[model samples]
Target: MRTDSEIKSDILEELAWQPNVDETEIGVVVEDGTVMLTGVLDDYRKKVAAEDAVKNVRGVKALVGDIQVKYGANYQKTDLEISKAIVKAFEWNTAVPEDEISVEVRDGWVNLSGEVDWAYQKDAAKRVAENIIGVKWINNAITIKQSIQPADVKEQINKAFLRSADIEANAITVEATEGLVKLFGTVHSIAEKKAAEDAAYLSPGVHIVINELEVID
Candidate 1:
């Protein structure tokens, strides 16, 4: 375990290392391993980078990014304009299916709701929304449409884990029902745990993945 002061110093250094983020504008507070970040960022992407940088530091528990996104004068857009632009962008994006998603904008925050056949489509919708000017934040409420049978879902997940040289396949367990997959067991780190969860999601017909994999350093 690391002292609170040590953890704070490491987080500050990490934030400074991120070229996209302005560390001076961000404030860090630590108490009992929980980190709370309060500040203002020029871009939403920079806000996300700060969170990721904090997560990369060990001995950090929960993270709360209460940072605000400060929009410039040139980036201002009306709610109606944002709505129309997002809808048009979705139509132009090949990865996202047309008319499969609905866009709602309020106070510069974009709310996306709809169903898509693949995870990539859901991700694509958010990606396009994030790059748009004047978008303060985004709420991706997209769902996946899966029609794959539950049979062999477990075996396929196991096989994927086995195929990956970085994963310990035997240490993980898979359970599937209809369109949902549940993962149980332990992983060496957060990266390995995410890898296992990604494998579960990659399996066809897995609309929901319940990851109960514990991280053991």
Candidate 2:
């Protein structure tokens, strides 16, 4: 097991290496295996980048990001302007169903609520919103339209794991109840853990994925 200090050092180094994040503006605290980040950045994307950097570090069990996004005067936008921008962004993205999603902005935070046929579409909406300037944060409440529960949902996900190069199918177990899927196992890295969760989400009728996979590396 890696010590907290060792984990902290690696997190700092990872943050510095990420081009989108300014490492000096952030504070890192590690206790046990959880890391807490506190800082302020000019863009919401930077905050996300910082969080991703920490998660990629080995030995990090969890993260608490208290990073604040305070846009400068030049980057500030009215709620109406933000709303318009989000609408335009959704239209440009082919993956998102523009008409099916609703957008509301308040104090630079975008709230997305609607229904989509696929998890990727819901994720696409949030991804588009995250890149828009002046967006402080996003609440992706867009839900996947549930269909008939597949009797072999768990088996289908297991097959997907076998086909994917990023996942080790043997190390993971899949459980499905109704439309919810639970993953329990061990992965060699954080990336692999995420891959396992994403594969589960891709399975039809999987409304929620509970990833309890431990990163063993």
Candidate 3:
């Protein structure tokens, strides 16, 4: 196992490598493979980028992000303006169902709520909100509609894992209870672990994915 200091060093390097993240503004603390990030950023995207970078590090078992997004005076906008922008963004994005989702902005934080047919649509709505300027953070409460029974959810996810070269389908076991899916097994890296969870979310009726896959790197 890598030491905490080593994990911190890799996280710092990863943050520096990401174009959207400012390494100097972020402070990284690592203990027992868990990382806590603290900083203030001008854009919410940078904060998200920082978290993603940290997660990509090999030794990171968990992450706690406390980054604050504070816009400059010139970049500040009223809540109404932010909401309008998000709505417009959703409308323009083909993947997001603009009519089905509701947007509420408070002090630059956006709260999205509604139901969509697919997990991809729900994710697309959040992605649209993230790109809008002055969006400090996003609470994606959008849910996926159960268009079909989840009786075959586990089978479908297992097939998806088999189709992907990144995943070791035989090594991972999938469990489904209604719309909730759980993954248990071992993966070679953090990226593979994430891939398994993403595959689980793509199943027709899956609403939640509990990724308990251990990284054995």
Number of the predicted model whose lDDT against the real structure is largest = 2
Model 3 C-alpha lDDT per residue in residues 107-154, reported as the tens digit of each score = 898999998878888888988888888999899998876656666888
- What TM-score does model 3 achieve against the real structure? 0.94
Error of 2 at 148 (Å): 4.4
Output candidate 3 Cα RMSD.
1.4
Error of 3 at 127 (Å): 1.1
Give the per-residue lDDT of model 2 (tens digit) for 15-61. Answer: 99998888999999999878999988999889888988887888887
Ranking of models by lDDT: 2, 3, 1
Stretch of 10 with least lDDT, candidate 1: 186-195
Q: After aligning candidate 3 to the native by TM-score, how far in Å is the CA of 111 from where it should be? A: 0.9
Q: TM-score, each model?
A: 0.83, 0.93, 0.94
Cand. 2 TM to true fold:
0.93
Largest TM-score belongs to which candidate?
3
Which scores higher on lDDT, 1 or 3?
A: 3
Better of 1 and 2 by lDDT: 2
lDDT of all predictions:
0.82, 0.88, 0.87
